[model samples]
Each structure stands twice: as C-alpha cells, then as structure tokens.
Target: MSLAQPAPTPSRWLRAALPAMFILLGVIYATWASRLPAIRDLRVLDAATLGTILLGGGLGAVLSFPLAAWLLAHYGARRAALYAGLGLLFGLPLLGVLPNWWLLFAGVFVLGAASSCFDVAINAIGAEQEREAGRSIMSMLHAWFCVGTFSGALVGSAAAGLGLSPLWHFLLVAFVLLLMLICAYRILPCDAPDPDAGKKHFALPHGALIWLGLIAFLGAISEGSLTDWISLYLTDHLHASEAGAPLGYAAFAGAMLVARLVGDRLKDRFGARRLVAGSSLLAAVGLGVAIAAPSFGVAVIGFVLTGLGVAAVFPCLFSAAGREGPTALAGVATLGYSGSLMGPPLMGYAIHGYGYVFGMALLAVVSVFVAVAAMRARLLV
Candidate 1:
C-alpha cells in the first residue's frame, strides 16, 4: 500500500488578521497627517501653497505604483510589504518636524509611495488568502480600514486634547506601526508570483480597467473630500464647535465600518449588482440631503447615509479586480489608488475656484455617475 500524503496545512486565520492591522495603522498615520493643517498654519503656508505641496504625495505614489507591482512579483508580498511599512514608519514622524517646506514635501512624498506599496502588497496577500480560504472576505478586510480610521480619529482627538506636538504624536504612531509590522511578519504568505505570468511592464490603465479606474477615482474623490475637508466645512459652514467638527468624520467612518462589517453577507445574500446599484442611489440621495439640509443634525444623518452607500463599492471593485487575474491585480490597485491621489487636490482646487458648497455639489453629481457605471458595467455580480 502506498503511504498517505499529508494533507496541506490550513494557514492560520492570523494571516488575514494582520493585513487589517496594517490598514488600521496606515489610517492612523493619515489622521496624523490631517492634523497637519494646524502645523501648516503654524508654519505660515497659504491654502493654495499647501495644496500644491499636498499634490507631491500623490505624484510620488503614481510614480511608485508600477515599480511596487514589479517588486511584489519579484520579492514576494511579505518582503515588499515589510520594506514599505518600514518606509512609512520612518516617514510619518518626520513630516511635522522637517522644518523646511521642501523637506516636508519630500516626507509626504515618501509616505505616499510607501503607503501605496503597502496597500497593493497587502491586497495581493489578501487576495491569495481569500482563494486559499475559499470564501469572500474582501469587504470585511476593508471594514477594518474604517475601524482603523475611526480609531485614529479618537487618537488624534486625544492627542490634541492633551496638546501633544505633531512630531511626538506621529512618532508614537510610527513606533506602534513598527511593532505591528514585526509581529505580522510571520503570518503573511510567502508565495512567489507564477514564473510564467509574463513580464508585462507597467503601463497606463486602459479599456475596462480604465473604466474601473474612473469608478475608483470618483469614489476616492468623494471619500477623500469628506475626510480631508469635512471638519473644516462643518466648523465654517454649520457653525460646529472645534470638538464637534471631527464628529462629522466620525459619523461618516462609523457608518462605513458598520456597513462594511456586514457587506460580505449583504453581497452574498443580495448580490453585488443589486447592492452596488442601490447603494449608489442611496449615496446620491445622502449627498443631496447633506447639501440641502439647513440643520446640522440632518447634515450628519446625510453623512451617515453617504458612508453606508459607499461602504461596499470599493471592496466590490477590488474583488472584481481580483477576479480579473493575479497579474492584473497590481495594475488595478494602482489605478484605483491613483483616484485617491487625484480626489483631494481636485476638491481643493474646486473649493478655491468655486466655493465649498459648489465643490460638494459637484461631488453629488459625481456620485450619480458612479451609480450609472455600476448599472452599465454589469460586472458587480
């Protein structure tokens, strides 16, 4: 009789868990960056100039994405992620303390590049893990990002209350993220890219991926605008107290996290096409209400609706990309992230040119296009 071959060992659930940790950590770092407006004010930079500097981070990420994809293919997800995380860990604390505007720009650029690399590498690992586990888990994975963002807000509020310097606050976050990377190292997958996956040099997105990229871009613009500017909007337009301004973002993020935690179940039960279409319409209505409402309470409710509507869209897009092919996944994620890079600056320019209300109204119109694309693409399911 032939000896029985050992069954393949089931990978630990911790592999899935670690990526969430990184998402959370990255979000915390972003919250730290949001606190930088105050730092910029202290340093005497005008809004337009600060906006220009902010664009540098996006440029760096755009430049880095193709290179990052190649590195992930060659070096494996874990190693690439480790290097990226280390870069972010070092880059975060330096942003506030760098003294010179150019130095600060350089720091933000490195931060953007490193974070983009980490994002793609982690998503690649998550995709592989999803295959191995034989289940849909992408939505829950992203829910953790919302949770992380919420947690980061809390941390930022506390730090602000205590009057901690930006340098010290970011330094603390960096240290924690460093420890997280060390702990997460073992659980991540070590699978190398298929030797025959072909040498497809990184190029600009086109075709269906371009449409997908546009969807991502619109979604990112909406989300980034809310995250980057909502606090100021509430404080200035709605007469919200400084402490209360963050609550607007908290509402947005909290609703998003709750919706995303349940998103996979919703997708499985309701199907992707239905979920995306309905959510998009709901988001459009939410934005409309947000813009039209005279009361802050209504505006907050609108923000919550907006969050719920958007919660599942990005994860659905990511899942769609994964289904496309492993080789294409990096390009897809990069293109999607390019939206993140583009959204904020675009909003900034719009606000500078057309006032905050018009800028937000434009986003509302953009959400309608997202709904239309979801219906037309028919790829959601």
Candidate 2:
C-alpha cells in the first residue's frame, strides 16, 4: 500500500478501527494521569519525588525515538501500532500494582515508550487513510482522542468519588480497552514495511519541517502547561473553592473538543496557514486574559477561548508532516513530544522563582510567537 497511489477502498471495519486506536490511546494515557494524585498519596511521595517519577515517562519517550522509527520502518504501521498498544495496555495495570515509587517509575517509563511508539504508528495509519480517502480526516481522528480523554476523565472522577481503588479502576479500563483492540486488530489495514525507510533510525526536522516542529513545540507547551497548572492557578490566584478548580481545565478541554469537531472542515475551507495564524493569535489573547483574570469565571472564559483557538494546530501540522512521509512525521512527533516533556517542569521552576502569573505570562508570549510563525510558514498548507 504505497502512499503515492490511491489505496484500495479501505474496509468499513478498518476505517472504524483506525479512529478507535486514537481513542484507546487517549483513554490509557488519561486514565493513568488522572490517578496521579492518588498514587502520590498512596506512596506518601513529596512534590519533588513525584516530579522525578513523572520525568521518567518523558525520558522514556525521548529514548524511544530511534526505536519507534525502526519499528515503523520494519514492521509497518499496523504491526507497530498493535505491538505498542499491547505494551501500553500491559503497562497501565502495572502502574496500579507497583509496590513503590521506583517500580512505579519503571512502569511509567515502559508506558511512555509504548505511547510514543504507538503514537507514531497510529498517526502513520491516519495519514495513509486520509490520503486514500482523498480528504482530511486527521482532525476528526484526533477529536476522537479528545473524546476518549473526556470519557476517561469522567470515569476516573466516578471511580474516585466511589472510593474505588486505582488498581481496580485501571484493571477495568485496561480490560475493556484490550477487548476493543482485539476486535479492531482483525480489520486494520495491511501495508508492507517500507524498504526505503529502513536506513534512518532517527530524524530531525529540516527545511520547512523545522518550522512545523517549532509550531508543534510552542503549541505543546501551551497545552501541557494548562493541563499541569490550571487547577493550581484557579485555586491559588482566584481563590476558587476546592470543588470548582477542575472546571478551569474542563472549560479548556470542552472548548478544544468543540473546536476539533469542526476543525477539518475549517481547514479545507480556509487553508492551514490562515487558520493556524488566526487561531494562534486567539490563543495568545485568551491566555493573556486568563493569566490576568480577576475572577475564576473570567479565567474559565479565557481558557475556553484558548482551547478554541489552539485546537486546529496539531491536526493540521501532523497532516502536513504526513505528506512529507513517515520520517518527517516521526521527526515532528519527536519534537512535539519533547515539548510536552519539558514544558511543565520548566514552568514549575519559573513559577517557583518568579510567580504563577509570570510563568503563565511566558506561555502567552509563546502563543503569540506561534501566531507569528504560522503566518510565515508557507509549507503548512
């Protein structure tokens, strides 16, 4: 199944299964993340210790770049995605059963590696599917990921509310996801491994790809910072009550969900460069407003705007990179993953030294930079 030729009409089951992979990926990731506080409390770990544990996941991802490229080159997307997905499912339950922080770090490391590998492969499949269909579907596929995250978050909240143990929650989710994967695998598209892709074990963004990576980096920082800090910001800055703090993130996520639901059509109608530039500018403004907001309600409004503004950047960027071939997409994904790894910790240090407002202000500044870069990036189409 060479991408240069229009692929055979994919089976309906294959098309359905492809999006399911993205959703399952999100469910696994969020299910683990939403349980972080619980795990910390269980182990009686301090902030620094928890941060160290989290760092393991990032390191694992970075280290897996070469391996991910190799897997995609040798095994192709279907086998690579399946193998990595199994690793993810296995790692999830391990996190729940780990006896200590060190073991937990090891589990998270495996999970992260699996996630990075799975991400690259699944996205490769999406790129292929989009090309075969002669349309843009990456945004809608990514939207399903958001759906999974939202669903996973809700499930986590319910489990927590019910006082269900993390072990039980994870086990249940993993079991269900595994069943879904089993069904999906039966119908996933088959492609022979790319012989040409074998020589490159790793990649760095070059030429126009460098700009695409830059956009991904800044966008990731903005997204990651909000996920990591929004609740704390609402609680500390606005004096939001305990029960209300999570709503800030909810507003952001919900807005992103809505934006992505419409993102593909918007991309087709307006072109990637124009849409990205305008949306990034909106994100900058929204983040600035949120950082300076006098009240919680105002902050939530800002977050909503930020979400709406930044939603289309990745799907567009990923689709563009996919056009460049597997290596390019892998390179962009690697760079973007690095930003996700570095953003929160860097912001933590900044906030500790300066203040919360200072840290968030930096994110807003980057959002503006994203806007400017998008306008100048001609190849983003």
Quick one: best lDDT, which candidate?
Answer: 2
Residue 269 lDDT in candidate 2:
97
* Per-residue accuracy of model 1 over 153-234 as CA lDDT, tens digit each: 6676667667778888888877876776765665444567646434873655566666666676677667766776666666
Tell me the tens digit of each residue's lDDT in model 2 across 307-342. 888888889988999999988988988877666655
Q: How high is each candidate's TM-score?
A: 0.90, 0.89
Cα error, candidate 1, residue 21 (Å) = 3.5
TM-score of 2: 0.89
Which residue pairs come into collision in candidate 2? none
lDDT of each: 0.72, 0.79
Q: Please give the distance, in angstroms, between residue 195's alpha carbon in candidate 2 and its true position after superposition.
A: 2.3
Runs with alpha carbons beyond 4 Å of true place in candidate 1: 1-16, 194-198, 293-296
lDDT (C-alpha) at residue 199 in model 1:
81
Error of 1 at 359 (Å): 1.5
